[model samples]
Target: MPAIILDDISFSYSSSPLLDHVSLRVGDGERACLIGPNGCGKTTLLRIVTGRLLPDRGTVTCAGDAGPRLIPDTEGSGGSVGEYLDASLRPLRVLFTRFEEITARISEGGGDRLAREYDRLLAQMTARDVWSLDARVDETLAGLGLSELTGPGRGRSLGSLSPGQRGRLRLAATLLVRPETLILDEPTNHLDAGAVGFLARTVNHWHGPVLMASHDRAFIEDTATVTYDMDIDVWRALARAEGADEFTGLHRCAGNYSDYLEEKRRARARHSELHAAQQAEKRGLREHRQAGARIARGGVRLARAEGMAKKYFADRAAATATRRTRNDDRRLEDLSRQEVRKPRGYELSFPMNPVPVRPGSALSARRVAVRRRLASTSFDLARGEHLLVTGSNGAGKTTLLSWIATGKPPAGAQASGTIASDRPIGFVPQHLPRAGDPGFAEEIWLRGIGELGRGILHPSMWTVPVPELSAGNQRRAQLAMALAGRPPVLVIDEPTNYLDLDTMEALEEALHRWTGTLVVASHDRWLIDHWHGRGLHLEPA
Candidate 1:
């Protein structure tokens, strides 16, 4: 039986529809991944599933105790750590109160309806194991690396926690709450390598259905049992048609991301073949009809010159032409009903051109430490060398990178260090600030790298504001703009955070080919596994 279902879900933000008659289902113990390019309505669909947003049409159903619980992209507002934990369990608290009420009503001589309600509530409680909720909470906290946040740390304000800590807290609370269906939107966004591995394990072993929207290819490949891809443009066109079916884009594939790619490739090839064949058939029919018309015209001219004997030949030729044309028209009508639409393809091209540098040590950091954030660290990077920083979340990778790239630590971070760099360095921080005066893409153009920027971004996006771009597109623009003036050194923090697989591959290739001194802090397993550079591993301070 399906644990979650969305039937005929149609939605629109403006005059144009984003999601139209989209239907999806996940059975008990199944894991489904929703993947698409940036701004393709993935977040919108996930919000609809979690009931955070309602669709213009369609119904959402979740089997079992409670509705789906979402691990959101952003954290909640002001609240103590303990208070947040308590609020997460409110659904369980409500169920417990209802159970008591139903029991009391039965004792007061209730009917069959009351007994059935009591039984249903009892099953829900049993499934959640409410008797051991406290112990489960402790286990969940520890598993997600939040054991310290409990006990003496529970009193800590949410504002005090780092962005990574806040993100993990949301994930832990959702896991401990144990809703009937679990839904996650970019769940691995703020996670480190170890934390993402833990998430994959927990999700793989989950008892209920799991539906997630993520650009983390490594995590999706590890945890997803089914892949739901909505990246195709044809699906949207079909959904907008007058008599479209409920499942406009039921492009569900079994297995992981790799399998989905292979299946989609084969399907696209078949669609192309069918379309090519239909075009050939139509062309042949048109040529044959024209040839018949030519024959009829010649026979008419011959008959007029010869008399009654050749008139019969002309009549016969005309009849044959009419029959041939009629047959071709019927064939064309049949082919129209089985027309095959072309598939959509996505591509990214990023070329980095680094400025020339003298051969020597490009940067050196001696005993660098940020107050309460980073421990003392020392490293030297040669000109044109590549260095990768590896660490768990909150282990100060971002803090260290900010110092190296900007010649200073992040705001409010007091640093004690000796960091020296002779050449200019281009930096793309984890969280980019707003672009003042010129738009983000426009900045790249002003730096005389408009051609390079065009490889990563569409020309139209050059005039758009930075805040209006999708996260993935924004990341692309950031990288393209960073290469402005061809800095001798480049520093990037979590470069793979919001990028789709294709764009990620393009960025990886560009990094490998670029002849620049590089420093990157990333938690992407796929990127890490493929890296062949020096590594700086950090432990939590």
Candidate 2:
């Protein structure tokens, strides 16, 4: 049997349906990736499979020997990173629990009765090498870049760690468990290039079933053997007899990330070629039919009286109208019978607005330092220059950005010496409250519609709540808000979060072309390697 099976599972929130009849199967030794825009129910699907959540309908089956384990993106459970990871080792837990029971029986003078049980448990722990749980936990923490948070003289409570650190902690915990099957949600969201690389090696070599939801192209390419794309459109129309619309469900592709990309490109090209051919065929048929009708009409005119022909008899007009209507109907029927699909993408194409940024120092930080992460360093960014900040998870990329965007230091970071910037900055951080008024997003998109193009926002989605949008759409909306004012310098944090590969590439290209200074905190390797920009590489303190 497959390691995990989800059969026609359905789930919903109060008034909105998130997933409909979702089904999936994952086998042992295969890492399957779930890729799509945000808000596509990837997290919910993982939860259902792990039995953390119950589907509104249908069932989930796990064929693994041990209970499945998961690493959720969001955080609420509390513990130090090390403690959390230690707790995930179930075999160790079993050993410890039995040890306590054995000690209690000894105290109660029932040692003989429990002696066999105690010896068996001890022997099992020794045989399985469960005593080194702490060592394995430490190793995982270091691999995930949580060493700073878990090492001696460090290790804050999970609540005190940043969101990114918490995500790393969860990942460490997941890896420590070594379950027969692993379920991970947005596993690459808060990781730096180093941590991502480390995790990629661990996952690629893991000999268990892995089901992961990720938007990182490189990570997916490195680890996944199969790709499952959740359907974007849940409102698919149904036949009149069916009454209600049903979801199109998960779209499966049997290849790695690169294969999926190549397949998509080929599909689009094939569609374009077929569409052109069909249009040409339709035009030829129409011309031939029209020519035949003209001949038939001419024959009718000749068959009529010579006197009537001179007047071009009224019946000739009626016959011409009838021919046109008949030809149009036949064309419609022929077109309907032809099976062809049009290519669809993000469908957004537009040039960035040109802004006359003053040619001078856009921003400068002299000997800037964050408490534990960013060391004192001086950097100058000139107008129209692009600055790429690179570092690990707990590094101070976000902290440094906040300092530049705002005049003061971020919460735990500090800036010293001289810092100067005359250019107005627009910053898009990793996290922002969803726009309260959906119309606000609508207004911004509308204002730039003439220059931004119509395909950026669908008319039907204008009124939907911003939080209801997929992650990619939310990023697009936030970008619209950031670009609404067209500031001279743009400071963005993790701009590629939750974005699909196509849109991510588009955004990177747009920033490359925008006529403004930019300071960005990003972990996307593709963006880093391809972007023609200056850099500040930070090492974790």
Candidate 3:
């Protein structure tokens, strides 16, 4: 029997069906990935398989010695770690109840004292390891980089951790349970490069079956042994063979994502050509048949025949109109092809104003320290210059950006610095704010573009909402907002987090055109190599 199986599962939210009679089976120890565009029912299907949700039709079956274990949606269940664990172990409560019942029966007999002693012993046995629970919790926390997750020294609550950290914690919890099967949804959502790397390794080493849903192409390449493509028509199993490159494999005929996209374009082109030929042939046949019929009835000279001819002509015109409509549809389909580009970071620039030569320096830092490391650091950023800041995880890259923005150093650090610029400074941080903020999407974006003027806000901008905007558009909005002040310097941190290739190219072009000082912190190798900037490497202590 398969470890997990979905038999003719169908689900609908509202009038639209999300999963249309989809069926799939995953074998024990198999690692499969579910991939599709957003709102494609990947998450919904996962929920159904885990028993957290019931499908409108059909059933999900799990055949294993350990049975099924479902992980609830974090947002739906407001339960803490302890609460979740308790719920998971609820079956154990029945055994304890049975023990209590036995004790109750013994106490009713003549040997009341012995029954009381047995009751005491039973209670002690059941709770023998209760005191050590805290220790176990602490160990799990430490493994997830939450060493301070115990006692008064617990400086940060679980909620305070970054999304990446929270994801790690979830993984740790699952590992503790040692379940036979694991289902993950968008597991790489908030992870940085290093964290993603760590997770890739973890998944590769996992012994049990895994079914993950994600939009991150890179993560899917690294982790998925088999790929499942869910479409409106059917669920497909992509071919997987030896020596396959995750980015470009047999599941897809072309190669990587870009290659697959090109293939789609070619297919669309062929479809259009065939459709146009078919329409032309049908039109010709219809016209020929109409002319033949008119010739066959030519001898009729009555007024009724004239009227019938007019009606036949009208019907023929309507047939021609239908053919034209089909042709128009084919043409529209050809023109509507969407091109997929590779992921790339964005380029940002600030509006410039000529600044007089400063007597001292553009920027100076003296005796700077961050995170109990990078002791007594000092650096200067000159005008019209570019600098790259490099560091590992938790090396204070974000802390430095915060300090620059707020004019306050990180905890246990002090710095004296001066920033002089002729243009307004623009800064793009690593993480963007949540999309739930108020404003029509376009307005929020226009606001981000800042005071760069109405020219930057194109007429098409109004059509898209801010939260629904792509990563590149969001970065553009942030850039526009920063440039609104017209600062002379631009400070960017990890600017290319979720950008695609085209947007990154646009950013590079925009930056090349801008005449302002640039200060950036990034880990993108391509961006670092191509960008016309100096490097500032931050090594771990």
**Which candidate leads in lDDT?**
1
Give the top-scoring candidate (TM-score).
1
Off-target runs (Cα >4 Å) in candidate 2 are 5-24, 52-61, 66-87, 92-134, 148-170, 231-248, 272-300, 303-331, 337-385, 393-396, 399-425, 433-474, 485-488, 498-502, 539-541
Whole-model lDDT, model 1: 0.77
lDDT of 3 at 247: 22
lDDT per residue, candidate 3, 1-541, as tens digits? 3387877788988888778767777777676787554556888888887777899998887664222363332333444545554454334444355566767777676376667667665654343223344465566556555455444434444455556655655664554444557777776665556556666676776566777776565666667767665531110111111112222201222133334335444544554454465456556655765564454443343224467776675566556656655665565454333212221222344455555434434455565556445434567877666677777766666666656654567656644443233333466667774443222244554343333423343335534555656655666666665566666677778776655443554566676666666677876645666678677776654
For residue 133, what is the lDDT in candidate 1?
84
RMSD of model 3 against the true structure: 11.7
**Candidate 3's TM-score:** 0.53
Error of 3 at 154 (Å): 12
lDDT of each: 0.77, 0.69, 0.56
- Provide the TM-score for each candidate, comma-separated: 0.72, 0.69, 0.53
**What value does the lDDT take at residue 236 in candidate 1?**
35
2 versus 3: better TM-score goes to: 2
lDDT of 2 by residue, 457-527 (tens): 55555555566666666666666655655677778898887677678866777787777788888888867
lDDT of 3 at 211: 76
- How close to the true structure is residue 16 of candidate 1, measured as C-alpha lDDT? 89
